[model samples]
Target: MSTIQQNIELAIERWRSESVSQHTLSDSSAYFRLAESLPLTDLDAATTLAEIFQHELTFIPTSRNSGDWFIWNGIIHAKDEKNLVDDYLATEFANALKKTADYATKYLADSTMSDEDKAAGRKGMADLYKYARSIRSAGGLNSLKTRIRYEFQQAPDFFDHDQRWAVMSDGRVIDLENVDEEPLAPCPERPVSRHLGVSQSGQWPAPASLPTRWAQALSDWTPDKEVQDYLRIAAGAALLGHGDAKNIVTLVGLSHTGKSTYINVLREVFGTYAGELPPTAIVQKYGGATNFEQHKARGKRFLYLSEPQKQRTDDAFLKALSGGGDTITTSKKGQDGVEWQAQCVLHIAANHIPEFDTSDDAIVGRMNIVGFDHVFSPESMQRNKNLVQELIEHEGSGIMFWILDGAREYLKLGHIPVPTSIRKRSQENVVESSAALMWLKEMVDSGELVIDPDAYMKDMITPKDGYAMFSRWCFDNGEQLPTQKKWLKDIEAFNHMPAERKGKRSDGHARVWGVRQSAHRESRKLHLVQDGGSTDFRDLLTQLETVPTVQ
Candidate 1:
């Protein structure tokens, strides 16, 4: 037979011998006896056999240390001879006796074997390899347990040492030294604060009744033709739902030009009986809550931020203000080394347009700019003041409050459709002041207001003519003017000329024609006077307004 076949036969014979002798010998003895019987002749054969048999040898080093065991193949060896010999004596004798009995039975069977029986014998030899593998595995388990015990004895304080035995009644044996005996304290739960709706005490009182002074003021007031026209358009736009009418109205102009006063009058007319305050105060009172819940609780339909500084406009602040419904969170360190988050709403207002440094355009688009003119006469200012005082006195009495309240209610229904024209205008002006004018023009075109076409044309056209004339004059007079400022200065100089030759310029030697600049300057300074030099141009504009002929 070949060397491999011979080794297979030997391994089978050893397995059968060990299996029968297992009952007679101690577990450790059986392992040692099998190792001794393993075939080891050629170097390769010896190594393979040693590896297969190593698992059966139980090692108990002289130092009683787990690390001292030298593992060969699957078996463990120790430097101590006493442990090796003891295990061998206990297991080898019985295994030898069993092997002797198996050999006797096989010898007898081989004598009576035929050609068919010879084939069966060869198959049995192959099955013996499996039996040898099983024996090796059983032996390895016993060796591992013995090594673990030796390791524990060597280092009683070993971090991973356990003295649990499977033979105990409960199958558990605890080492008293390994127990942790400290008490653990329980933790208390923290209380959390819940937010309640707006407090009754925090709300401003509603007016009991409309006062009488408001009516007298509105009736007695006679606004300048220009001022009246602007107010009428503003009111009509609001009534007709043009642009962001009920949303936010931004009055932008020079500081002393009555922007604040204009806002005040609007507040008196719409907020007096409604118990609404300006946007800044409202934001402050609610701790800057920008959500729908807080706004609804505070009974706010409109938010107003007056004269916000340029520095205050930031991305976070603008996002909150521009109906983005975003909150701003600021982290602050607490006394206990913890951080906190504070949130607030996004409403804002400013005296000047926000600086261009901000990267967020959402905030800018949501705001609308109303340019206030500084050309109001002294008489117009008096009339506006009287109208405002009267509205204040009649506070809760006027129908205007009801009208504003109705508008708010309508908006709350959430189905207010934006007309296509209005939407287009809003889109154009969302980033420009030109949107406000477009909104005004659309409102007039739609017949939302009772504007006298003649009066509006008269106001818009006459000023445009004077502006054009002054522009031409600057070009003719060798003036280095390319901007409005230079042209305005020249107009002012011409206006101060003597009345006798208002349209003439004296250049020391002789009088020169000054029709254009002089006409513009004179009309502006004197007021109510038309620049007659442009009568033909004025007629053309009038004809265009009156007749709808194709140009």
Candidate 2:
């Protein structure tokens, strides 16, 4: 009855006419053009148009569509036939429009939402637009697979055409190209025969002397129960092909606190079966390569880079560490006056966190930081010495082989979920850990592992006092409080501090300082003794206490 309603009806009629007349116009482009012509007198009109467009786009993929032509035909038919607008689609669009209108009206009336929230909302909408475009272009499940395979084949340096592909129940094709040759377990719906690997060669050659060496190493050394537990899990993760398990285990502690000793023991364990190379060997072997070549070389189960210091942390290292399921390349000079490239699995262990320049939360969120908060007492040192001797003497034993075998079997099963305690520790300070957790949950759902959902939630959701300490540290360092956008900056500044300054001091003897950027100038101003200090540093503490809190 209203002018706006009449205009909408008229617009719909015009769209139907245009669609039937010329079958060439893209649904999205046509919608945009129609929206431009609409008399959007209020926020409701704009919201209504957005909702309708979104619904129309979403339904196009779900319909019986083949290639691009089928999609175009469906769009044309839907636009032309007034009766084609189902009740369900119409209701859904109306609900979406109402929600948007409500939000706009509330914001106009109260102005309570911050500019930052508004910006985030806008960005989310933009991302949604891109997602809609991708879904539309793909058309259907089979089309999606064809597109994916085509993309994979076109990948630069992708040498292995003999890769196997498995179609998931959700219609996604998991390409096993350049991945380990081990056959994956089949899902319930899929036939077990579908889970076979490309290399039909029953089993790859096991490291000939691995069993003997592992037994000897285990016999010679005595590891603490907790450390041994971690090692077993790591080894199992490696053998089972859980890439994260074999990559790197950061042993954090003060100097001479057995961090290096632990690594040496692990090396000895690995050395029994295969020749363990130093960090330099790994760096040189796969540092320069095309993305596809790098992916192929990454077939190896494990890599170890030791003591990656502040200076050693760079974009290349960060990319290699964080971006799983992606290939990376570094250019190098070849003997034949041509460029060369190498690729391998990136496993790195650093004494300190990486110092990155950007504020991209996604980058840092990919890392798993395991803290070694235990202190090294005199008793612990004596125990370490005894273990060292034991490992040296017992170079080969069945008990050690059995242990390695168990670990390997556990990893291969890939069904056992990571213990709650371990997952919690790794997930701390990492946002993308949510995705990792989801992957773990999927494993549980697939009956690969048993999980106590409540326990897992408690481990991940409940914040501890340590989060407070981290928050205070960020505040004292003149960084923004806990936020996804400022995570990298906080990490960079934290990593730059001296070892003593990394942890909190009850005595107030430790001091943390940094430079704070000023709006008017290019240079930053230095802020020293930024937190409350001990009586020994009373004057500095008093001055620091005077500074305003960031409320």
Candidate 3:
């Protein structure tokens, strides 16, 4: 094979791995470029392609520009943008042809036809579909009169311009398809096919006025300006046809805090585009490989969980998903777990933020915690019962506009910076996450869990005892052992003391590494006083303030 041809094959192999079952000629598309390098003219390109690739070749000459672009199977091997607008258009055109094939099959199956008529129709009018559209003059499906507007005609802002917009964690628009859409499958004739919000259908018609009233209502509803913007941005992000966002947004608030109403508005605005990943019931509470598989298999752009704590969500799924990107072994029930790109933008609402060993920065880094202190009692919600529906259905498009604008901004900045209040609360949650760590730090400070410096002088403490103490601390805190290695490193870094030493377990079986108090903690404290440092989180070990351990 020629070098370029070999390059084509390599690219197709990669596409095959990533394409899942989308085995359309378009899906394995590096092969499309094969025609581009050929010395033949544009007219000859199609002939050469047909000659080279025999795998179910079907071609369509577009109405707009006949000479330039033709659909070879589902692949639009266009020379330039003058021909191909976007992937959506290419896919839809292929669907229209696929539908025609089904229609032909039905017509050919008609039993009432006379024998001569049937044979003649087979060779004539029906078979005319073969070359009827291919002729240069009579533009097949592309006939301006016969053309379908299709969804690609909508969103001139997105398609006309190269810029992409998506939603952020707070549900606003920023900028940024699943692998799983069958290439040859018939897609419905709808404008907004890819990312339809739960209560949406067709393209969102921009109202005479953008939904400023919803913003006003939200302003009236929320005391914090940042949170209101956060909500708006998150909503816009959901409108994002695609997203690169990796953070999970959770609204933790008191009862009747408008969370339900707010989320209901999102449900109405987002429509079937959202759902819980792994589904709430399909996931086991404690967690298993299958639950992780379900998560990996999740194909939604927006996965909504309205108070999942009520369902007793699985902790393993929560932990794994929070720090996603693991090429997890996932499969359909009885099948072996196949690797899939884990990409679900989670939007969660709950009364309490479910802590998932959040002390470690790895897990903490992925969290976007929004504190919802505002409460609208049931009577208050009852008084304004229809407000949510109006905001969602009527004023919703305007709000969608608001989100779209935010999405545009997000594309530029790359990320929406979480408000400081949310960050502070998250930090507090982390420190307060572990009662055992809190107790261990307290006991160490108070000389109760003292590590003798002289014992270290003898060089005798095992890592196992050190981990045991760390584990025990987690038991006391009601948290998992987040990062034993990090904890040891922090102890040595913070106190300037030896946190670990060569020692033996209490059991007479073997000598193991033990969690010895760092020798440096005392020096770091001394250094704190020597310098102008006021001991305001001077050491990571001492960052957590004392929590009452009455239990």
Candidate 4:
């Protein structure tokens, strides 16, 4: 009968006919306006609007903060830092509450209201304040925070495409029209973010020009098709979040050689799923607070470090990133630390090989090195100046297909295929980075050192300890000798067996490793001896065998 009652009924009638599910609460501003007109005693009307808020949003309280609010669109999404959804809801709620409080005061002075109405108004105002306090303190939007609490979920096997979900490498896109379907059903946890920029059409025969152009860009890096194929699969692994590949890809090349261009394209397409490598990720800092640097990569699928100059790579951090099994602990400034298994594949590009603190197999085995040998001529550079943007704009869909195809291939193979170029370069990076490896490799190449495998069975200790020999070699070459412990580890990593240490200091058996001077070098020395005729290596061995030991 009253205008306020008529307006509230009209709003409800429109809600039933149009379906409140069809639009978010923010889109239906008329309902909030009706709440603004309702009498203060109309607790039922306020309750209805509050119930709509519960259906539209879910709040998750964090340990030390008010927490995050997620709203449902096609899929539930967290309130983005840049978005105003939460702000809009807060403003509307405040306005409606303010209007009702004003009504509670205005009705007190009104001559039109019956005596029963004034007494009910006073009670309603007290009840409204109590309700508002409950909402402001512990209850949020009809207790939505408690009733509908949910954790943000991740679907590693699926990536967000446009506004829908598509199975990675499968090309089957989920129809979000009915989200209550098996995988998309509204549950206690749900994926609330989109990472991929392009969607798979599931159609065959991608645009030929895309691959052709991509091949051209890659050809500038390497002429080897296997290397190109490996790079393609690496991209696929990145897109599919397959850190299980357990290898970090290093793109080594000169400027204008297309390495950064390639990385930039991936970063652009990966969007939120790709993270920039923080300084602490590669270089370890001393005496600093708990570095939250790794936290930036929490949900990322790919991380890129570009042109890091003259810094020793953090072996432990990098190993943990690609190792797949290690759980990394990261924290915010005041919040509690969170632990997660890193699923991100790292790609580091630099003009030269990156130095490392150590050169063990853990370092060698986890690296995938790709060299971009060609520096594009000024003319070629001029032509492909905007190569990355061009490829992304014109061939985005095809590129997505290419990457997904690589994911499918990687899944089928169960591992990334190492190309000859990649293997060679990766080994070179490890060897060149360690002084012990360099000295050992040089000695081997010059016929000055050889592995004595027979000594392993005989438990023979060389007259000279291998580490001592390496120390002397380092002094001769003006290189610093690594610690003895590291020397052993490096040699073992170089494919030589662990050194055989026999008996205590009381016994004559010295702690010697399994390396000795090769007969080639010894014979060469014999050739230079004037008093002694050039003795063959076989004769020298016999003479040494006949010699008496100090023991």
Instruction: Write model 2 residue lDDT over 84-155, tens digit each, in one string.
Output: 222222323233333333443344335445565554444433433343234333242233333322221212
CA lDDT, every prediction? 0.34, 0.35, 0.45, 0.58
Best by lDDT: 4
Arranged by lDDT, best first = 4, 3, 2, 1
Report how far off residue 30 is in candidate 1 (Å): 92
Q: How close is candidate 3 to the true structure, as a TM-score?
A: 0.48
Query: How many clashing pairs in candidate 1?
Result: 14
**Which window of ten consecutive residues has the lowest lDDT sum in model 2?**
68-77
Overall local distance difference test of candidate 1: 0.34
Over 4 Å off in model 2, which ranges?
1-227, 239-247, 272-300, 311-323, 330-403, 406-417, 429-477, 480-551
lDDT: worst 10-residue window of model 3: 154-163
Candidate 3, position 142, lDDT: 45
- Of 1 and 3, which scores higher on lDDT? 3
Per-residue CA lDDT of model 1 for 178-242, tens digit only, reads: 21122112111111011111111111122343335543333223223333333334332332222
What is candidate 2's CA lDDT for residue 455? 27
Candidate 1 positional error at 4, Å: 99
TM-score of 4: 0.69
